[model samples]
Target: MLELLIIACLQDQCREFSKLYDPAEVSLLTCMMSGQSEVARWQAAYPEWQVDRWSCGERSTRAARL
Candidate 1:
């Protein structure tokens, strides 16, 4: 999955994004870097998450949900 994600990032943006994982939440930055369909890729990555949903580009709120 990391290799696939790196491929997507390298192909799409020529930039790098870091990865961090938690038992509770996922990162949108990680999702965008993966270059798969935004919604589908994210859900697939963390099928067991029980928290609320979220997205990137939010400000002043730490941007995490649930």
Candidate 2:
């Protein structure tokens, strides 16, 4: 599934966060189109924070070793 990545900050305190779109979009075009609303929702929740940048991509998974 794809995820929407967001980098936002309150003044100088920066943080990175992401969420997977419900049901998931198949292509980057779809992701980009839908990402705006997702961003808006995030902004509304944290009005004080400013969004530095955002994008959509496949979710990253950490490898496990024995």
Clash number for each model: 0, 0
Model 1 Cα lDDT, one tens digit per residue, 1-66:
121122123233433222334413545466455434654555467554322333333233344422
Compared to the true structure, candidate 2 yields what TM-score?
Answer: 0.76
Q: Each candidate's root-mean-square deviation in Å? A: 13.3, 4.1
- Candidate 1 RMSD computed on C-alpha atoms after optimal superposition onto the true structure: 13.3
Q: What is candidate 2's CA lDDT for residue 43? A: 95
Clashing pairs in 1: none
lDDT scores of the candidates, listed in order = 0.37, 0.81
Where is the poorest 10-residue window by lDDT in model 1? 1-10
Clashing pairs in 2: none
TM-score of each: 0.25, 0.76
Tell me the lDDT of model 1 at 56: 39
